[model samples]
Target chain A: MYLFRNYLLVFNILIFFQVSIFANNRDSILVIGKVSNNPQKHYSYLKPMLNYAVSHMKDLGIKKGKVLMARDNNQMIQYLQEGKIDWITESIFSALIYQQTTNAELLVRKWKKHSPNYYTIFISKKGNDINQLTDLKGRKIVLEDPGSSTAFYVPLMEMINAGLTLEFLHSVEKKPSGNNVGYIFANSEINIATWVFKGLVDAGAYNNEDWKKVDHTPVVFRKKLNIFHKSDTLPRSIEVVRNDLPDPIKKRLKSILLNIENDPSARNVLFAYQKTKKFDEINEDINNELNRARIVLNKVHENLNSL
Target chain B: MTMIIQCLKKINKLIFLILIPSLVQANSDLKPLLEVLKENETISSEQFEKIVDAVDNNDKNNLGIPAQINTKKNDEKELLIKIDNGLKISTYDGSANFSVGGRMMIDTAYYSDDKQPIGDGTEFRRARIEFNGKMYEVWSYQLDVEFGGGSADAKEVFLSYDGFTNKRIKIGQNKAPFSLEELTSSKHTTFMENALPNVFAIGRRVGILYESYQENWTFAAGFFGESFDNDVSKEGDESWGLSGRTTFTPVSEDTKVLHFGASLNYFDQEDNSEVRFRSRPESHVTDTRYLDTGKIKDVEKQYSYGLEFAAVLGPFSFQTEYINTHLERKIGGADDLDFFGYYMYGSWFITGESRAYKSKSGKFDRVKPLNEFGAIELALRYSMVDLTNGSVTGGETDQYTFGLNWYIKPNIKIMGNYVRVDNDINADEDGGVIGDDDPNIWQMRFQLDF
Candidate 1:
């Protein structure tokens, strides 16, 4: 009787398992993706970091995924909501919008050059005698892209923090120019670098990556420009996952990923990229910092709205 | 004559009552002509009549004058075609769109004068129809149909509900996701059709599919399956089965996207049922011998296995898959056959643009400037399969393919490929000997959307 009962129980369990497959069609997982926009040409500095991420997905159970090549923030967000993706590595502005709309979590921030920081570098022509950030108050300045994290956000924030009033002496007309001191979306850092070198803009602000590429401080503005100020370091890019993901799977993925370098099985994929060590533990301090950024932006938005 | 005059007077009175005060709304009114107005209303009517009179005279500034020559503006809607499988209908706002797409491939095989010719090289490959779209903010669906020369003709439809729960439940005809090529959209296949190994175990299937995806991973499970083209009535109780597949890209949102995947299928055939093959036939028996399709068969048994791999790079990428299967055959004499096949293909863009994605800050842009002429792409593929591991023979087949593609626009592309097939015969002599005897085939395709 006991044996028969056990067999019956097993049979019953099997049947139940079979029925649930069709009965439950309502489970979900987060989908995430990011693109370097331009790896070979513009964002070459960030390529090593991306390769590290690609070579080591087996440790996280990811087998086949697509890296979308995109050129605009709008396209990136569209992919995210289209079920074509779940996660994204993007600028703070884009991430802010996604987090607010999708309730996606900010998992971890990257540390560039082994430091969790970044800053904007202001540059000018060779010999025009623009020594201070304030001195360019009424002059023209070139901006890389309106959505650029470093070229726009960092500089804008620093300006506000420093109480430097911005009066659009005149908006930079989007014309193809070697150099002109106006807010122009050059579409690339090299273009911006070239513009400053050729005496197009009176001054400009770019991240350290762009600054490092230029051999001469300024050829056109060789005597015109000087570093007026530098902003404080901000957090690097972040890795985020949807909060609704299963805890166990998420935990396993995170554990395997954070310590990928130590796992023999994951070394080759991880080693493809550089400037990445490991995912450190996240805590309240990081959250607090993110909150501070949000607060600052909210204030700006409120001011804009009131006006 | 007097009566006629009196009637005329009454008609004039009625005309006045109807036409005098309502003259302002006359443009909107359609009525019988010839009416009279009361004397008192005639003053108001006179003013109205003056307006009408002015309009009747084609006055330059009358209310009845043509409402500006440009009142009816010609606002035309734009049409965009997405190449994924359908032609999408989008409005000016781009917030809403509906897409309808389809594919049809008729391939005839002509078996060369080999020692044994199974059916020569001649048969219809596939006839397909697909409907897909994003209805609004939170809904999307895809329906597919297949009709062609095969063991069976069938219809497979999947109604997908995406976004509501971040889950997609496909109820209809599709794959169970047991293989890498099995889950990829057929439209994007490197070959005109999937490998023969896929036809045996991971062919297109029909079932209840529940799939969930995260940034780099996808988990899908389903049950109550159907054969590739089997009819619902023929299934009976034996038709029931279970299948599931999981896919993950460990490195997503990076310049190089890497992925891994695994899948399973389990079935319980009816007692005394001769249903050994799933959707595709395992072997073709002839007077000479049997031609294997690379499948393990069992009358009443479970089917399951695992597959894993990675895909990486930008304008260039590569993929690999490993599979294992066991079968329980009804005949006591033969054991289940086991086989494995792996393929790697790489693609590079000679043009400035990159692969299309839904992100703005990515390598490629669909809305490239008009100054750009077009994009050129080159791809190479190599695949090897060992089909005689567990059967009566031991033979391995290898193939190399090279392709060149021209993308004239976002919605148009022309592609041509040359493939070389090499065979290594080690199994029974009946397996056919081709001491590296090779064959080269050429194919070309032109694709357009929208």
Candidate 2:
């Protein structure tokens, strides 16, 4: 009975969130939003593309482009609801929130890093004897930031589904009691890799793509690490426009980005924009993939938070 | 066969229909699936309506609806773009890519002659264009062509595949798994030139290498032969070799790291049976080698091993390596020889920009400046090589070097190194110069990469 009440409460909260009011703060300029703790890097990456997009949108009343950075996912959602940001590129988990909670339109799917999907992996030292997700009990694992889908939510979901009880570690020194897995957020992928490599924690979780990237998971560290667990493929990142954005403007912006790869002049600009190859329309295949992804994402959000 | 497949699909839908009346929830995900089937003509309109009515719809849930589906028309191929990351000439699916980049290092040296006349001049140390890229995501390749030393040569031309789990394989001309100092890319090396002990490192050879690494350690091994441009005129059959290296890091972070590694190289000179060991005085402007073994014949096998250690703490870093080489005379009694060398170095960034270290390759990466002007670093190194053992008094020499570097940009830098060479009595260019000679060398470089 109590479980049912909790479900009811979660459903009510989700419904309340879905009926969000978008602020009509539209102006002559187009605002591109990003969620990042490192504003400088994110700004430079977003600026050129925003300028390119705005340049092509002069006929649609977009005279200039501005980049706004949100420090976290929740803040970015608030910005979108308030119409302070007209367009945003987001990872799957946060993108799901914007899609469900507000009238934002998913403009196109961004092939981030040129791949439409990436998976999360759980890593431990080579000889930890932790071969599977269940072995993480009574030990600690490190994650990236709370805003990360691969580093945080997907792994959290896997643990919950595996029936492992979770206890949040306030510090590395803290330990979980019997039969519980303790976890902490290390703020960056490299930090998570470092903590696991140094044995400050029993394991770490992040995307498989980062596992291959030398800068994130150093080659030295990879020599003695073991990826004991992997999650299902998650949806790639997405681009979305606020619900109230003009239809013509939204369509024009999307058309420009989907065709950006064919433009010779935008070569460096596209390369600098984040190694994006081209945007894709969310076709039937993608729609089905997204359905599965969102279901698990919703459950992860609702189930993990109360714990 | 197509008709059979279509029939199988319809049969699956019939099963789905038979089960849904008992299992379907009004807000269940099956609504989309049903709509898809109907749109694709898997179910007739009459049948769809009948099934839609026969199912007892439960309470409506508003948990999973994208607003665009309810209020906006999304069938149009409108677009949106986002980028935040990676490589070049990349395919849309990230399966293939290509990029070209290279570096130009122009150097000048002033040799303070002591007992020998060493040339003092400027030259291009390394002028090379490199083409590198990935194909099919897991396959990668690099081709580096060097136009230095008044000639053109291929350096580190290789193709690699990383498709396996936590492992990679490379085949072509590349560096053997040997020294931490030798493996680090020249573009990011602290000093303009490697230390005196680098002569013991058998650098870039044609080979195939296998590498596997985990969180705290790495293991690399390879089979190699003579360099690409080896002369077949005197060819009694090229020497073949095997080399392997293993490294472990107890701690690795953004600004803190501790690394220890060991390597072994074995060469079989079954037919050639001759070798020479030589090195410059840690400076390239003068081709005069202060230490040279000339030629040692009747060699059957060559054995070498190296030990390496390095660390980085904030803006300060330390590295040391020791190498030992032993040769087995095929037919001579008591004619075996041994040569050993070692180098220790430390560097600090006074401008507070830490030397970037790549734990992946166990090497120091390029350091970028923090401020607009540039970054400055002061470094010192002490290296010793003793090629004099038993019957082979090739020579022995030691060097003390001081270096200062100014990195004006990530891709451009200026470096100055002052080296003092101390030679023993047998230290001469294969009896071509006076032994016990000492030289003070000052060298500078202007480097840029694109």
Q: Candidate 2, residue B270: CA error in Å?
A: 2.1
Q: For residue A300, give model 2's deviation from the true position in Å.
A: 23
- Lowest summed-lDDT stretch of 10 residues in model 1 chain B? B278-287
Considering summed lDDT, which 10 consecutive residues are worst modelled in model 1 chain A?
A38-47
Listed for every candidate in order, the interface RMSD values in angstroms are 17.8, 15.2
Q: Report the C-alpha lDDT of model 2 over B189-267, residue by residue, as the tens digit.
A: 9999987778878899999999876556788999999889887687477899999998898887666889999999999
lDDT of 1 by residue, B258-314 (tens): 667777877665543343321111111111122233233445664657575645454
The local lDDT score (0 to 100) that residue B48 gets in candidate 2 is 73
